[model samples]
Target: MPLFIRSVRLYPVNDNETFHRRFSVNVAVLGSLNLDVVFHCEALPIPGQTLLCDDFATGPGGKGLNQAVAARRAGAETSLLGAVGADASGDALLSFLKREDILTHGVVTLADAPTGVAHIVVDRDGENSIIVASGANRAVPADRLATAGLQALVWLAQLEMDIEVVGGFLREGRQAGARTILNAAPAIEAARSLFGDADLIIVNEHELAQFSGVPCPAGNDAAIEQAARKLMVRDDQILIVTLGAKGTQLVDSRSSFHVAAAPVVAVDTTGAGDCFCGVLAASLAQGASVPDAVRRANIAAGIAVGRTGAAPAMPLKDEIEAVSNG
Candidate 1:
């Protein structure tokens, strides 16, 4: 059977000031928070080789933080449910989330651990390679998730935090009658066990390959569909495989289709995938059909890749509509 589908209109806002009260749908993100240290280079360094470029920046990131910000910017009543260090980095992250009007009540501070961090290298073509240091992110207590009041209509989960913790949230969220969406990033083998808990699963080509243990198709939609079919154990579960500039493939037991990517010049691809997942969850919470939500998310992610940074790069609902209408 197809998932629930409803028509949702875009919000009209002059600026970020109106995001909090503008949308009716509520969403909660359960994952990790990190400080991203980014470096730009002419080309990726070879072994024993060093290259330098002018751009260097640091900003708030991690799958959880980025997705929460993206959902909020896309006009959802968003809350971030995760842990941060008790130091300055955690304080700064909380301030940023509050400034965006996303609820920080679910975010906790841990005294014993340092904040998580990521070192990212962006090449001239907007391609990136990242290495993460899972600091305070790994310290998220399972009890915290159990205690948080996740009254939202939708709950989004990712792999940046402990996989078991994320699974627990997904199970609990489903029991509460809230729709659950899982974005399986960083390609962990354990994600395979949690697929049954999600009403929808969003992943890139690589993640799809990793989860299914099936080789990803190379530029062939038919082959991708075949591979996706092998991973669908339940009739209700929807699978979305993001194909970068090539767009995405949507798979369900009833039907499968492709959504084309929006045209845009690329600058940084750091959180483009995260932008897609966030907007999709927010759109679904507002009752959008799978195809409509995926189309809007494609546009939002295209806009994000044309800019830099993760959370800061996410496009608001109006921005997505502008490009979508044009």
Candidate 2:
């Protein structure tokens, strides 16, 4: 059966602000935190072989953490709800978030559960393979997250937790009258439950298939759009299929619109999708309809892909706006 969903407006996202309280957008992220250990290889070494890294760094990451920081940098007052180990990696992660200004009040610190860490290998061209040791993150016990008064609730989840936790959060957001957006990354079998509750399902070309079970475009945007239209409320709920340089195709309750990608020589595509979704959520909280928000997000993503590293690559609001206005 088709996922049960509600209708969403189709107009292009507008760049404006409408808040229940303040000027900035407010967003809550229900997800994980991780310390990213990167291996900068010219090319991935063969299995059972060793490849040396030319450069490396450790930083705060994981879809939830990346998206939260990106949203905050993009001008959203964001909060993160998840667990982290009390290790040195956890300390640095918290410190970095403090610098970025995301609400860390809700982070659960576990002494024994060592903070989650993702071992990543990225080739010179930015293609990557990652394995996550979801230490503290796996503590996703099934419970409804307390939803106070946030403009939106987002889930950048990995299926490291029970599906009940995901379901509980969605229900909590609905109860609190917040826009519920899910950035279902590393799409897993249980992640399927997200569609029914999401106001917007942000997907890359590969992830779109993982969710909709529909094959991504065999060739072009038209094929992809057709596939996306099959999932969720194609004409109602927001279905954004990001096409890298090809830009994005947004389908809503009425008609679909295509936003052209801004040109940039990509140094690292890591976290670009998270940047886009983060901006999209922030822009939506700022009262931007999908088109305007997504247009601006496309520009923001361009800025992120132009640099290296995950969190370090996200551009600030002014920088993103400058590129968007250009």
**How many pairs in model 2 have backbone atoms within 3 A of each other, for residues 3 or more apart or on separate chains, i.e. clashes?**
8
Query: What lDDT tens digits, residue by residue, belong to model 2 across residues 1-326?
Result: 12222222232212331222211236777777889888888887788988877788788887778888888898877877777887888898889989998877556677678889988888887777788998988764543233334334343333444567766777677676677877667777677766777778777788888766777863476667777776774334888888888899886666677889987887778788888888888787767877998998999999998887788888899998787666
Model 1, range 214-249, lDDT digits (tens) per residue? Answer: 788647877778778777778999989999999999
Using Cα atoms with residue i matched to residue i, what is each candidate's TM-score against the true structure? 0.90, 0.85
State the lDDT at 298 in candidate 2: 91
The number of the candidate with the highest TM-score is 1
lDDT of 1: 0.84
Evaluate all candidate structures by whole-model CA lDDT and list the values in order. 0.84, 0.74
How does candidate 2 fare on TM-score? 0.85
lDDT of 1 at 209: 79
lDDT for residue 34 in candidate 2, whole number 0-100: 88
List residue ranges in candidate 1 displaced over 4 A.
Answer: 1-25, 146-148
